[model samples]
Target: MTNLWSPITLGGITLPHRLAMAPMTRSRAKPDGTPGDLAPEYYAQRASLGLLISEGTQPSEDGQGYLATPGIYTDAHVAGWRKVADAVHAADGRLFIQLMHVGRRSHPDNTPHHRQPVAPSAIASGDSMFTMSGMQPVPQPRALETEEVQQTIADLAYAAKRAIDAGADGVEIHGANGYLVHQFLAPDSNHRTDEYGGTMKNRARFAIDVVRAVVDAIGPQKTAIRLSPGVATGGIAEGQDNDDLYRYLAVELGTLGLAYLHILYARNDPLLEDVRRSFGGPLVLNRPGRSRQQIGADVSAGLADIEALGVMALANPDLVQRLKTGAPLNDVRSALFYAGGGAEGYTDYPAIGIV
Candidate 1:
């Protein structure tokens, strides 16, 4: 029987267990977009997990959206991430840096240069985001010209290489969460008549191109991507072809021989089976709000090869040990998740058997 504690290999790296730490945006970086000192300790604390995916790190200045989130495109940022990579590796943990671009779901106040956000089309998320000042409306983003689109693809490739240089075992493209890639996939958000919009293949073009670029820069075996098909976050609506779009994406991305494809969804979704069959590679499923008892159900059922957890990994540094002993999980303070405090809610979460 497949168990959560069973060993597995991902992208040629052997893991002690099959539970991975899902990436969460903690807003813990410095104002300059470099990871703070506490970032290393925070990640190393949870190194007991089989793998740890870092928070949504921007690939470029314009890719940023929230306050204090880290970037991977600069020298200082690379230096900062090296510390994190060292810490996690010292604790015998594998890490993958997630590259996220918020696109239209951004406010100028939240960006370093106060630059206008860019998206697949000239449209706002029609939502607001948390800024240092307070909640601010997301302004309409400028649509990327064809040339600019190519540059954005190049930017992702460069960032992936930077992550490797910073000592990350791999990189996961943040194509989920209604970010830049999802914006292009969702019909309601992408209205361009150009080659990048209109048809399913065209809509899938940007994501495929970005993934190809990253894979080319940092071998396919060390590259991965996270995708959410039906999610409507950030004013995104997939319309009718959600399944077809993902089917095409699964097939296209599957051909690249990526490390793995991470899906954020409930296990009960029928599309899960479709995606699993379509991808034909190691699959990681992130099913939120699961109890300890349900941890390995997907793996045992042959639905997924690994399970990713967010709050559980965040609150329990020795999560694998706790799960083994069936220890009660520590509660997480939701209010402190994005508070940007040093170690109060970041690394202060005690492990099992600790006072």
Candidate 2:
């Protein structure tokens, strides 16, 4: 039976286990979009997880949604990430930098350019986000002109190439969580009549294009993407057609021979199996709030090839060994989840013994 500890090969890398560290935003990057200095140590500590997907790093300045999130398209960003990649690799961990474009889920005050956000449509998510001043309401975004949409896809490709230059094992496109790709997928968020909107196939065009571009920039083995089907985060409403949309999407993505497809889900449903069958590749499933007992359930059941952990891996740097020996986990300090005083709650969590 395939379990969490089962050896698996993904993207040409043989991992000792199936447990991977999910990308969680820590907002710890520098103001210029470079990763913080402690990023190397933070990731190196979790090297036992084998596959560490870095926190959502933006593809461009306009791609940033949260404060201090890293970017992958610049020299400073590349150098900063190189340090992180070297650290993780030295400890036998493979790194995949997640390229995320936040779309309309951003605030002007938080962006490098203090301008309105952009998306498939000019619609606003009507969500609020944290900024330097305080939490502010998300404003309406300008719709991307057809030309700009093409440019955005090109930008993603460029970022993927840059990720390789930084010595990352691969790049995972953040197509989930009501971001730019998700905005194009949802009809409500995308009102375009062009080749990128309207029908489900059309809405899927942007995502498919982005993936193809990234795959072209980097080889298919060095490229992956994360998707959330039923998630309503960032005011994304997939509506009733959600099931059909994803079936079509999975089948389409499966054709590209991607390294793996990461699915972020809240509950298990037939849709999960549908996607697994249609995707037909290594699937990494991240079920938020999954308990310790349920660690290998999906993998054992053949529903997923790998399992992703967020808070559990965050608190336990030696998560694999701790579980292997049955050790207690540290409680999460929710208040300091984001960028805060240096490494208090970020990397101060003890491995197992030393105090």
The alpha-carbon deviation from the true structure for residue 124 of candidate 1, after best TM-score superposition, in angstroms, is 1.4
For all candidates in order, the CA lDDT equals: 0.90, 0.92
| Model 1: CA > 4 A from native | 266-268
Candidate 1, 1-355: lDDT as tens digits? 7877779888879999888999999998988999998999999999989699999999998899999899999999999999999999999999999999988888899898898999999988889888878888899999999899999999999999999999999999999888999998889889988899999999999999999999899999899999988876899866445778998899999999999999998433678888889899899999888888888888898888999999888888888888888788898888889886578888999887788
How far out, in Å, is residue 161 in model 1?
0.4
TM values, all candidates? 0.98, 0.98
**Model 2 regions more than 4 Å off:** none
Top of the candidates by TM-score: 2
| Candidate 1 Cα lDDT to native | 0.90
| Position 151, candidate 1: lDDT | 98
Worst 10 residues of 1 by lDDT: 265-274
Displacement of the residue 157 alpha carbon in candidate 1, Å? 0.4
Best by lDDT: 2
